[model samples]
Target: MPIKLHDFQQEVVNKFFKSGSLLCVLPTGTGKTVVALEIIRRLKEQYGNKTKCLIVVPANLRSNFVDTIRKFQLKLNAEIIQKVSQLDQAYRTKTILVISYDFMRLYALKLLRYKWTLIVADEVHYAKNRQTKNFAVLYQLRLNSRHFLGLTASPIANTPEEFFTILIIVTGDRSIFAEGMQLIKYMEIGRKDPTWWEKLKATLTGRRPRSKKGELIPIGIKDIEAFRRLVGRWVYIPHYSKIEKLGTRPKVKSFVVRVDLDDFETKAYKYALRKIPRQDLKDLKEGTITNARLRQIKNIIMACQQTLLSPDYIYEYEERGQEGVEQSNISLFRPGSKIKAVAKFLKQTGEKTIVFSSFLRFGARLANHYFNKLGIKSREYSGAVKPQERKEIIKQFEEGDLQVICLTGAGQEGMNLPSCKNVFFLNLPWHGEILRQVVGRALRITSKNPFVRMFWLFAYTKDGQETIDLWLSNLIKRKDIIRNAIFAALQETTANVSVQLPSYEGPRPKSKRKPDTVLGINYPR
Candidate 1:
């Protein structure tokens, strides 16, 4: 049976087949899996039973992919390959084999020996870091495969440089841009007053770059439009609004809610900051901190953040000797203002909500508070929860048995919670991409709620002095500027270019739109 596809997805699939390698970016809940499956089905039909496909996904997402295939009722021979020993047998028999990134990294060389007709990397941004072993493994596999596909909702999560590896993998051109110094030079090709060199020198010598006006100008993307044009050729990004059949996605209302810490908590925060070494503080003030000094400074900052959240996290960290700073002598079990604020917000909304925390102890403490204090049915979802238990928790949350769930970073990647519309961040991650992925758990296209409300909870001082939360928020805003600029380019490219389909041996379905020019390449229209 032929699988049904939305018009935009069909168009995207057509583009992938024509180009042989491409990156497909679709907003969460917009059915990226369906597009991949449709491409797989076509490859099977075109190449016969001998066609081989490898789908690499994050560990937590493996089940989601399998469940999607089952829901679609697709008869494609897909199997989850868990062991390196099973790889050989599965490679011979299965038409499509899905493996996790962790497993792939472990058996990279073994898997590289085999040829795959198509390689689909879901959440492909995981390989964006060139320093990661997964990137090296995926790079080789991309070279070995006949066709490569990278899928992600947020490609440039942190910076534009993250896209460099993904581009090289798809385009298979290591020298496409050039090496480090030359690459930086290329990025500054059109700049009138190039500052990359000065920035690099300052960075190496523990100094800051300043403009002619003596204002700090952080080194960042100089020409986002040029980068967009470069990356636009290999990417196909479609929004739900553009694809009418996908239905209207609810508009998201995001808020940054500031909570004031109580008197004692404020005192504890100040005490924690005082515990940092005077030399370290001076280094930070002078912007001359080494790697070790920077790490210690980060630890102190985290201790201060934990101070804002709860005393329980601080005690736990102190016990583990994780927080080098001294813990304030206060009641460790008492819930602080942030925790109380979260409880109040949850009780007031009375909607299914998910609280995200980067720290495990904080999430557990919050979940415990909800269950014991507020009487709201809640549980913790993190790496500590067994896979089977995680499934049960998700079932409970979806079926209304649970009202709140505290999710840690471990559960962020592959967990889908469309039933949840309210997301509260007890803590902020350093990267904007991570924040997006966590929020994506609820902002699915299939969500029942019309609007997904996201609250970023922050703690501030009475004097309005900026804290880690505010600093992190500002960082995310800067990162978003890069993402929005590149996405704008991709959106324009998608609108202007038309994919030229190959001639079919038999009949073809009719369409109202005609083939248009793409990247100066002429084909049958």
Candidate 2:
């Protein structure tokens, strides 16, 4: 059967075909690749087989793209090339070239020798960083390619400056920055007083402020009235109530073990904090100093002290052990007291569970502990796992051979794991997107489950809560924006339709200069 395109996918293709370059934003699992493939198909049909297309993606995802293309059986010939030298041979054929972002810098000059008809940038937000070598290469490619397209799910930036840079890359217009600034100014003014635009236009142009009688004049008010009717209105209502029928909920019991810092661990943490910033140390370095400079001194002192003291001073000594003591004490695999609690819960509940950790070592340790000590079935997938092995682990998880799936963020992306409804965050991911992906494993649309429970194991401290809050805020904002946009579109469809006729009936003339005003404008700072 031929591949089918969703309404959103079709819309994306239509927009791209109409415009030379576009930034296509859609949520994950929305089949962005289908939209991209449709564009490729249409371009090939229109321009013939000689046309070339280049797809840039993250290094880890290169295999995933290749698999997708093959599974779909797209007619377009595609090659996955990582080296610059390979491009010379690959460019001879009318084929789509998929490459990693890292390889772009190494082979940019070589690849630029050939002329590409179209270039598609996947995860295009990364190309906005002007300082990166890959970004520069991509920027030059944008100017050289006949057509350009950018695809991303998360396009919102923390600041307007970053957003503008992305827009410029997608649209190839420096003026987009100025337009964005103008829109921001208007939005700020409108927030303070909704009628600020009328006042500003009147003040700046020395025109009479329109009264209720003048409102019917239809020059300025016509457009405003039309827009108001088109966009409709949105309002929020707050409600508070006490629950009469309280429900019992399953509780995720957790235990925190206070592992006293040994002499070596204390010194290592101090050294790690001093040598590098405290923020740089990940969970893996919790009780160990991995810094090269401090390791030798730390090892020598630890070997001399036969019985290391807790919170003891670590000074210089002779006759230290060859191996570092810090490495020994930092047990990434230690079951701790929490292991028994987790194992007992699993056996009693008989519910499939997912355990996540920031450090792969910790995940491995937990998986091993459950398997060896508790005789529970478990499997681990992380960056260290070979591609083939990772696939096999996923297969096992889906087949019910594994009761617990222990993994890091690397395994979370593009993988479907719906057997489990209970998810445990052994450690939190820094990015909100990663967290979403991890939890998404339990949220398969086809599953019969009524609800899924996600357990976040955060330390009972201000810093941990702050991090969780930041991630929560970002998630809420993203959800709200998408919800509002969809609601607005639905409202527009339900409202009365109005059409305006052009003043002139002759064929529309093309202008040499750019349009005076775009839909959204921002004044430059």
Candidate 3:
């Protein structure tokens, strides 16, 4: 039996057929794998059993792709080879070989020697980085393969140079540089005030460019309308409020105990300040101390020091009788401190929750506080975990043995965690794509839960609030676009209906009780 294809899959396969070397940019869950399979089938038909196909995927997702292929039961012989030594003479007989990015470098020379009919690159966005060893190997394979296919949810790189690297892999042409440069130049001319010289550099290096509308457009392969439609369907449940409404809210409370930094933090701050040359400060413009500027090591240490020592210098309240005596040195964590508050609330309500932090160290510290100090069962997934161990940890969580899982964004993309009802963003991801993917883990429709609750922990700081606001605003805009697109598609389909007239022609019926006063008005009684 032939494999069935989704609309998007069919479209991608058709493009692959038309363009021997094609780069496919589809959204997640859009059946990129299915398209690749179809391409393999088509190639086998054209070249018979002589054709060999190589599929490259991210290191973390190597097993996931292997499992998918096994489930599909395709005719092609597929093996997930992790090491170069494993790709001996016996492995060469297989039609499709799946290798992780890390192993690509070791086997590139040998792999390139073979007559690979098709080279399918999964997560093809990584190919844009020419400096990477995997990318260099893949580029050589692109030259060797009769046909090349690049697959990614979002293949658009941060710069035009990266974008052309992907294009070069697909088409083996340097001319895309000229096209991208032209677009960038056009964009610079159209804009009244360009934000950064980097933008111009991006155009020259294939980093950034203007859309046809002359707007600064990021590199993205996804159909905007499709992404919007998918996101709009995301069911956001206000679990915290819902439980409160049911009168079974979590009872555990959080207390923010502020400690005065005993000289260490103050010294660190002073050292940081001294490191910044006086000339740099003299040249600095007002309002230049934004998060981007403050991200420097010195500035960050200074800020940390200041925050640590704040409790000692900044008093909450002063008594009239004793001027030096402080009324309250510590402030209680309120409902607004979403991270701790949510954790506390979940503990009270007796629900399993997942807390995501951008920094592994911060996540581990938070987990230790909850598990070690508070005795709340919590496990962490971070960069520290070995690949083999990460799988085992995931298994433990999925089996309901764990109460709370504090993880960085490592497990967001491909890992399945249907048991988690609540997802708290302890720290927001910088990119919108990452944020969406992280939230998506909990929103899987196949889960037993009805709705997923997402809590974004935004600090009272302007930057934190602005990040949350921007995310919300973008979500709303995308939702509207999706809703409109769905409606428009429906209307267009309805409008295209052709009606056949009966043989007998009669005068159009007129009465219908004067159309039952179609227009209603506010009438004075």
- Which candidate leads in TM-score? 1
User: Candidate 3: which pairs clash?
Assistant: 159-206, 159-207, 160-206, 160-207, 160-208, 161-205, 161-206, 161-207
In candidate 1, what are the lDDT values of residues 401-432, reduced to their tens digit?
A: 78888888887777778888777788777667
User: What stretches of model 3 exceed 4 Å from their correct place?
Assistant: 185-339, 348-352, 368-375, 399-403, 418-420, 443-451, 461-525
Worst lDDT run of 10 residues, candidate 3, spans 495-504
Q: Mind sharing the TM-score for model 1? A: 0.80
Output the better candidate (1/2) by TM-score. 1
Q: Which candidate order results from sorting by TM-score in descending order?
A: 1, 3, 2
Q: Rank the candidates by lDDT, best first.
A: 1, 3, 2
Expressed as tens digits, the lDDT of each residue in 308-347 for candidate 2 is: 1111222211123223323343233234222344555566
Off by over 4 Å in 2: 157-162, 181-345, 349-353, 362-372, 418-420, 441-452, 459-525
Question: Which RMSD values do the candidates have, in order?
Answer: 13.0, 18.2, 15.9
Return model 3's CA RMSD, one decimal: 15.9
Candidate with the greatest lDDT versus the true structure: 1
Model 2 residue 521 CA deviation (Å) reads 51
Model 1, C-alpha of 470: deviation from truth (Å): 1.6
